[model samples]
Target chain A: MTDRSRTPAENAELALLLEVAGTPKPGNVDRHRDLDDLRFEQFLAGSVGSARGLRAAADGAPLGGAFERAVRGMSRQSGGNTQFGCLLLLTPLVSAAAAGDLTREAVRERCRVTTVDDAVAFYRAFEHVDVAVGDPPEGVDALDARRGSDAEPALRERGTTLWDVMELSADPDDGVPDTNAAEWIEGFPRTFDAAEAVLADDGAVLDRAARSFLRQLAAEPDTLVATTHGESVAESVRERAASTLAAVERTGSLDPAEALAEAFVDEGINPGTTADRVAAALFVALERGLAV
Target chain B: MTDRSRTPAENAELALLLEVAGTPKPGNVDRHRDLDDLRFEQFLAGSVGSARGLRAAADGAPLGGAFERAVRGMSRQSGGNTQFGCLLLLTPLVSAAAAGDLTREAVRERCRVTTVDDAVAFYRAFEHVDVAVGDPPEGVDALDARRGSDAEPALRERGTTLWDVMELSADPDDGVPDTNAAEWIEGFPRTFDAAEAVLADDGAVLDRAARSFLRQLAAEPDTLVATTHGESVAESVRERAASTLAAVERTGSLDPAEALAEAFVDEGINPGTTADRVAAALFVALERGLAV
Candidate 1:
């Protein structure tokens, strides 16, 4: 395989960028040309520079200010909650991986990647990364591993779209007219479109993730308190997890097509998952907004 | 004050919106605007139509559907839980309030604004609507409420900014950088700045309130399963709450904030506040976040 073919990080970056550029017919648009047209040339260029720096650091390429150190420093500073910082680190890492500048194994060793396939990738990454990033739990993997154990769709191909997963249900109490499943589904494309716009504009995934994560975190009691100070972020997170699970259960009974986020929380809350303790709470809220 | 001026719903909307719009000029340009730079036009239009219809309805004047509904519906929806809808409802209401259409009594009835201040006059077609937005909880009123609760600086009055109340601290674990009180204060101006662009482009006080309310709700888990649906949402929420309280207790020592949250939760979970449960959780989070 060529250097490009050998590098998963490069592949991931291309895939992610392609996902951004692709939208409908990802390949049709001259993504490279529009990179500047959209005023994202700087972000893309910065990614490349950061990617090279990451690879140089990972390879121990006699680098000064290696990403590894940045990661370690950020992790410690976050009180081990590197979810926010990790994204900053990973955006570059993924780009490097896509550029054939870094090895997947190296990236995993530096961190850990149980599976990047829809189920495995999300669940594993959830566990491996810090809570401030995207902590997933250990038990949460049973569902994914069950699928992973069988291997049907390849990684990146299997995850369900927000539209496909969200199910609209009529609440017996919500007699007020207007909003419906169709309206809800319609909301998704718009929100995703908006999210994409925001992401492209602000390449700082950590800040975005922090915002996204906080959107969910803001659902639990004292989460605002916990967020300002990490002292009880995990606990507030856990409480949020339980609350979300219950909501999912309610929504599940109310709307069958809607994904029940409780299972993910169940998995995430399990201490064995490392970060599941925090992930359990976060995943549900994130999923709810995803449906939007 | 005219009898119409005494309407609580109108007063509440004016009080809250002006309070938000004037919030000591966090440096967010949105703070300086005519109709919040037109971001909440739809909502404002809706409320204005509601207000006109209301006057017509009160006077028993002949009116069109839009106007009639606007006049009739202003006081229909219960303000039990501020975030009753999926989207956290506050933002839309903010737009309505900012429009300054609803009568003072209407605003007062909804938000229960206590002080005898501009919230009443700001919205009236005439002056001195009998609106009295309520007083803040005892100690919370330590800051002179009568003097400067307005979101904006009164024509020439000097007042403390939201910056005065913010607090921050550094973390000793995980090496995450501490969030400083000064930094939060500093960030407020920037947040205000970013918010202004949105105010101009689309959102303002309503959006701010909605986001803030959503942030509060996001921290308070939603799925209250049993009564909500024949699901585990309530159970999950309860479990998470217990866990969160536990985490709060575990983190170093129990501060006054935890006690407040615990009190709210204890009351909310036991007999249950039902619709107000989310509000209870949010209040707990805000209080906890506000604790010194």
Candidate 2:
């Protein structure tokens, strides 16, 4: 029943919805659970609100402008930053798909061609919502996202393209990789791989997405988790995901994962970056003919 | 935090999402519950898929063509007929909104102006999914929705515009009013009134939507339920809803409604048509500055 002819913008929006609808996605808002502040309906509103920006990306708008517009739209909900990182990853991929190919090389080419204007617009997106980002590395204070549009002069003076900024943030000094930034630098390896995992799995598409999310989280520490908590907590969370996934694989039951979901929510350990990557993977899978 | 600047298409899409996300809606799919066949994610997919059709409606496409396209897109999900009635109600409202006004008069004018071609297209949409529609009157056998495109000649011969078709179906021979069709004939009174109820209520927006849904169901028998199950059963369902609403109002708790939700789902009594009206009401509310 998959509608493969859907526009890239439609697929991206579906990915966002599917990611949030996936159940027992430990520590993140899903169909069956909600955080204290962020409810599931807010995510639905965010996806609906972001449609214009997604269409803009598919129509070949500048990356920064599209992302900023999407972020601003997403923030229309009381839940401030429901899909900031997801939009960050999807905007370029949608553009790449709109360009006639969704290959890694195409995405890489798109990322590589980003201009300093794109970088400035990306910083401007930060002004729309409160994203929990770690501090910029030593000498890059002028490019901190918290500086918002105020950093535009410095970005122009340094001749920093969006690609250059991604490279700067791809590997942080604290040893926690900025997974979304790394996707830009490395052409979305995890996204493509997890998409394959989703296509290979069984059951509902959203359930498949939940498993892919667990796999992604198990494979690496979530950047948002590392930034919000600490590297140690992030690593432990990844280990928990790895163990929970292994148990589910052996038993063929989601019970263990569901229990872990409750514990993770209670502990306030949200692997949001991993969830974002899973959403990107879902878009890739859907675009490549994964059934709904 | 509501984005009042969203297009009519965007508001319609959000209304679909919000309608499905509302919890504890007896006998219908919601964020916390799914029917044996239809999951929450399919509704999400339907909303995502229907965006183009919604845009078409907002862009002044022929009403039948827009509704047919939206229904076709919605059927992309495996769960068939996820939002058929909703699209039926929303199509004209979106078109009215697009025509520089969302007033009841505007909607009435749009409905009254629907062409025979629009009636044919509306009939054609039935071919895309198996909707649970009642049989047409004896004299109107050739206009049965189950006849799909085969009824087109009859529609053209009778010079039946979409408005005329709604008028024929609005008050069934059985006394079970087709709420969605009734919306067309009466200029969407229940939709506008239920929207006011949603806006006047308190907690989460989805919860308010759920309450409004209950009020609508309590107020009248759901045409779909009456068609699938007997009119007596539909009347009983409405009585249960009324009592549940009264209890919830008296106790200031949703526990009774939640219990009723479980029983209604177990009995296989889905008030899908009433739910569709709630979605239209939600679209009206969202368009008229209901906060997210």
Candidate 3:
């Protein structure tokens, strides 16, 4: 609503801050709550620390390099991997925004054009923090991110672009959906859709973002939950989110959502991938003039 | 400690985040609470929006212009004037740090060198938000910040530099102290001292910042409280903070601080000036390699 214009980097950083500030986001760290190991302040620190990388992305730095730098900066906080997937999603979006087009098509085009060097840098980023990415399928063990820079040779030999790697991981036959990867191949459909939802909703912008996060969680099984637990557990979490969101809709209250948040935190069921997508959605919304 | 080195602008932005992230910061907006009008997310938005101004300062822009830009950006959030005083303190510090030294002497020199244009810019910044500055002295009505750019002629006619204006306002004959202005004249003593306290304290960095905030509040009456609710109320708030700090020191527990925070918020007493100093202190701490 204010007249101040923000650069792509500023909007990306704002998106990170707004996403974490949205309260009662089930199983994710928000302003009011934190998981046992990750405090809300760490998310704040991660958001601040990632500014350089965000700026670099906005300045049209290569996607993998920008994403890796952002992850490295984010890992400066004690709470590890605070926004790894978020940065992974935001980097390309920021680049697209910087290119004067923040559309899904622009981001998808950027993703499609990523090179082998970008893929190598993406793997190298894993050296900075412990991300719970589970094991790669048996044949692709050599390309695991945990190998860090050691996987660069495999990536180069196979001519695997970052986009190719994303496609490989997008929808595994094992039933564990990598939503972050899926966004790459699918033109970031969830992020764009969620941005539209955020713009359509009323009340505070952050409150709208919390609602958007819940909607996304309800619509899709969070990949982090699927990877850490099982597909069924992820599905059940989605169902819980759906019912909680329905109750909120029915009563015009977020109280039910808060209860669900508490239960999810207590159960240690973090829907981190959904949170990451919401962060990207926030960026899109901000770029499209969704006011604070 | 983080191995990554940060620019002055990055440190300043991180300081804003860390200060707000610290919980149980009595009478101020922190992670766990909000005032009736100002929400924690607004602070986050303000911090994100202020980055360009912070960067401008670090890049050696004129102090008043940089500060005005920062305040203008911060005002983009619906919560008006979220960090005006904090930005006022940080702009010169960032300029000093960008000059390859973050010492008190460096910042004081920067403040002393500010021009009348800077003073005009400072006044112009007032137009962007509703700052609760109360009334100026009878004769200085022409120079009141509420007059905005209209005060420029008076500033020019009197040859008043920003530093001169700050000195005029610092430690006024009236009981209410302008601590932010006093820092301009006194070489930022409180900010540096509190930075040392943050560095010496144990546990999380945010916990240290919260403790630092309490210590600062205990040591001096908050100027914002004095301005809003008279000097006696400010003094009483300081006494309460002192007692609460003593309880925390005696029991090695922050539980007492939480109760005091609830009481202070209920009473609608905000020690905003102290919070501003603490944010500046956090910037100093971060620049000196205090870990997140």
What DockQ results do all the predictions give, each relative to the true complex? 0.01, 0.59, 0.58
Q: For this target, which candidate reaches the highest TM-score against the unseen true structure?
A: 2
lDDT of each: 0.27, 0.90, 0.90
Ten residues in sequence with the least summed lDDT for candidate 1 chain A: A22-31
Candidate 2 at A206: error in angstroms? Answer: 2.1
TM-score of chain B of 1: 0.21
Clashing pairs in 3: none
Question: lDDT score, residue B60, model 3?
Answer: 90
Ranking by TM-score: 2, 3, 1
Q: What's the true lDDT of residue A103 in model 1? A: 36
In the order shown, the candidates' Cα RMSDs to the true structure are 25.2, 1.8, 2.2
TM of chain B, each: 0.21, 0.97, 0.97
Give one clash count per candidate, in the order shown.
82, 0, 0
Those runs of model 3 whose alpha carbons end farther than 4 Å from true positions after fitting are A1-3, A173-175, B1-3, B173-175
Q: Report, to 2 decimal places, the DockQ of model 1.
A: 0.01
On residues B189-278, what C-alpha lDDT tens digit does candidate 3 reach at each position? 999999988888898877888899899999999999999999899999999999999999999988999999999999999999999999
- TM-score of every candidate relative to the true structure: 0.19, 0.97, 0.95
- In candidate 3 the C-alpha lDDT for residue B232 amounts to 94
